[model samples]
Target: MPRLVLEARRIALTVQHGLHGRRRAGSGENFWQYRRFIDGEPANRVDWRRSARDDHLYVREREWEAAHTVWIWPDLSPSMDYASRGQAPKRERALIIAFALAELLVKGGERVGMPEMMRPSANRRIAERMAESVVLAPRLPASLPPPFAPSPLSEIVLLGDFWSPASEVAERIELLAASGAQGHLVQIVDPAEETFPFSGRIEFREPESGDRLTVGRAESWRADYDLKLVEHRARIRAAAERLGWSFTVHRTDRPASELLLALHMRMGAGGTASAAPKGGGRAFVSRGPA
Candidate 1:
């Protein structure tokens, strides 16, 4: 099937502040360090509105409604070009996923940034530039770096095959978790990667590396292939769980939009699933995986 391409730049401009392209965070109060409400501090900071009712010395945290930034990285590795089931290549599918998410997040007023593949912010100009990149087609980044740096904490969206032996995929998620930002991993896979559903003395080519191997009936090695595949996926999942990062697996068989809907809901977007229910009266957004 075919997919629709949306302008990337429009989305970036919208979510820069958060909350559907507008400000929704509770207060612009100045956040002072957590202190027991001293008897003589300003009554306004006492959170007295909640005081007489609860009779607890509650200190108010001044939160700046700074913009919410979402970093999206799409894997352009050759492996992503696999698409056994449909017309869209896995690489294009990855881009579609990134664009759709940026659209939704921008609709919610959340800013979006891409590390090396694309620039920061999902605005009209950036989107147009990204579209141009898609058409002209340059080589991908030589390699991925740890996704997060010593920068302000923000959300991250990773689109990739997660095939590197180093498990750099897992390490990146852990870093993001440590920094107290949300992480979403979208793994785009070709059906063949899992099933080894081939036979005959076929020559196999590695997607990332140009290495080739010929496996014939005498050396089918199907069982071994499946075992390694299972182990690789398991390790990725275990790492995600340990890091508390949200993970989603997408095969070319499924619709990209449907996959996106599930991911967005999990990240506390759309109505399918509400961002883990509010605690007491305050809405608590979980920084780690849900």
Candidate 2:
């Protein structure tokens, strides 16, 4: 647990440095641009320095100085507890990413909450609050997040394996989107799950149901499994797009920093998942770690 916390903090710092590579956030005090002053506006708000250069009066619009609340959730289902050899469990990795993202958002003057675990706050202690709460929170069924209406225009970040039926996942998100909330889905999977590397005599167990299946030769099923996996991803992606939400995939074996960077950029720009910046570590690589 301690190692995971350390890793989360480290990744947050690394991503912070590269934040400039993405679209600039609007929560800063820095000046963004100047616009023409309108009638009935306060004259005191005018920027005389810039207005002197222009024929018309202008007002300096400091970057939109408003803090937004981002609600984050790391799936606590049994399936998220799976981890392949030498890899971090999906839940651990998801939480790490969530914690790190919360750190970044808080640093950017944004309020962050872990739904029922923690309340949204921009206070510097929010990250620590989130970390401690996640460690002690009781586990719930590995199902879609409980139904709740989000504040209008609020952002939601869901980190999970998302192995649930595509139709069910889509319905949950549709409900959230219906509440006028924007969202980003980060699907975290084990490399082994992405690539069926198992060979002869493999035993498979459903983490949530404890159901088991034994295959005499798993290699023969690899092709079919891969094909089905691709179709599943397409369905998931379509669901996210229908509501203008963004979706990205990550693997346990890869560095979380790259995905974190893309997420930060997308949220900062208020862009949809498809519009999120790409290119690092082959964003959305097929049959490979994302």
Please list the residue runs of candidate 2 whose C-alpha ends up more than 4 Å from where it truly belongs after superposition. 20-67, 139-141, 268-270, 275-290
lDDT, candidate 2, residue 26? 58
User: In lDDT terms, how accurate is model 2?
Assistant: 0.75
Highest lDDT: give the candidate number: 2
Candidate 1 deviant stretches above 4 angstroms: 1-65, 85-87, 117-119, 122-126, 132-139, 142-146, 150-152, 268-290
Clashes (candidate 1):
16
What CA RMSD would you report for each candidate? 11.8, 6.5
Residue pair clashes in candidate 2: 246-273
lDDT by residue for model 1 (219-287), tens: 366666546655666666777666556666676555665566666666643112212211111100101
TM-score of 1: 0.66
Q: Which ten residues in a row have the lowest lDDT in candidate 1?
A: 280-289
lDDT of 2 by residue, 54-159 (tens): 7999988764445457899888778888777898788888888988898888777677888777778766655577888877878664456766778875899998
Cα lDDT of candidate 1 equals 0.56
RMSD of 1: 11.8
